[model samples]
Target: MSDPIYEQVRGNPKFAQLVKRRGRLALLLSAIVLVSYYAFMMVVAFAPQILAVPLTEGGSLTVGAPIGAAIIIISWLLTGVYSHFANGPFEQLNNGIVRETLK
Candidate 1:
């Protein structure tokens, strides 16, 4: 594409909004995952015994098992959150921009 056409798309208000929204969403989700994973790692590093504690009086399940599972679940949920935005408003804005730019 020519510089002018690219510049034209960049100048669109909707394009700017889309960029900001997507950036914010991605940063938010990334921060969540990073904070969670780092917190878990810190717990592992500083309190290994805490994670070793059994979930029940006689049960074999360790506390770490569920917490680890939750981290994975949270990652999946974050992905879904992004996908939800991408598949809906983001996609609509993106398609509209493409159509407008092409025309």
Candidate 2:
């Protein structure tokens, strides 16, 4: 790879140590996030109205919605969280790893 950051940290003990310490946790969390993502997607796909709803004060919200939208909304919230843990953490870890190895 033509990555400068990686080339910089070609050989370093601390970098390996850091990866050893945090790699497992990062991987585990990332897997969990991915699983949750899949689960939520499945739910949404099988039951979409389970996520799109409107609030009603007097009567039940039966305005053409499945009424389970609330559940779907909460599930959708997990999507961003999953993305953060998976993509965000991975990127940060790569950058940090390169920087630490270099220095």
Please report the candidate that would top TM-score against the real structure: 1
Each model's lDDT: 0.96, 0.59
User: How far off is residue 10 in model 2, in Å?
Assistant: 11
> For model 1, what is the error of residue 88's alpha carbon versus the real structure, in angstroms, after optimal superposition?
0.5
lDDT of 1 by residue, 1-103 (tens): 5699889899999999999999999999999999999999999999999999999999999999999999999999999999999999999999999999999
Given candidate 2, what's the lDDT at residue 19?
Answer: 64
lDDT of 1: 0.96
RMSD of each: 1.5, 7.0
TM-score of 2: 0.35
Regions of candidate 2 where Cα sits further than 4 Å from its true position: 1-17, 56-103
- Count of steric clashes across candidates, in order: 0, 3
Q: What clash pairs does model 2 have?
A: 50-68, 50-69, 51-69
lDDT of 1 at 9: 95
Once superposed on the true structure, which residue ranges of model 1 sit more than 4 Å away at CA?
none
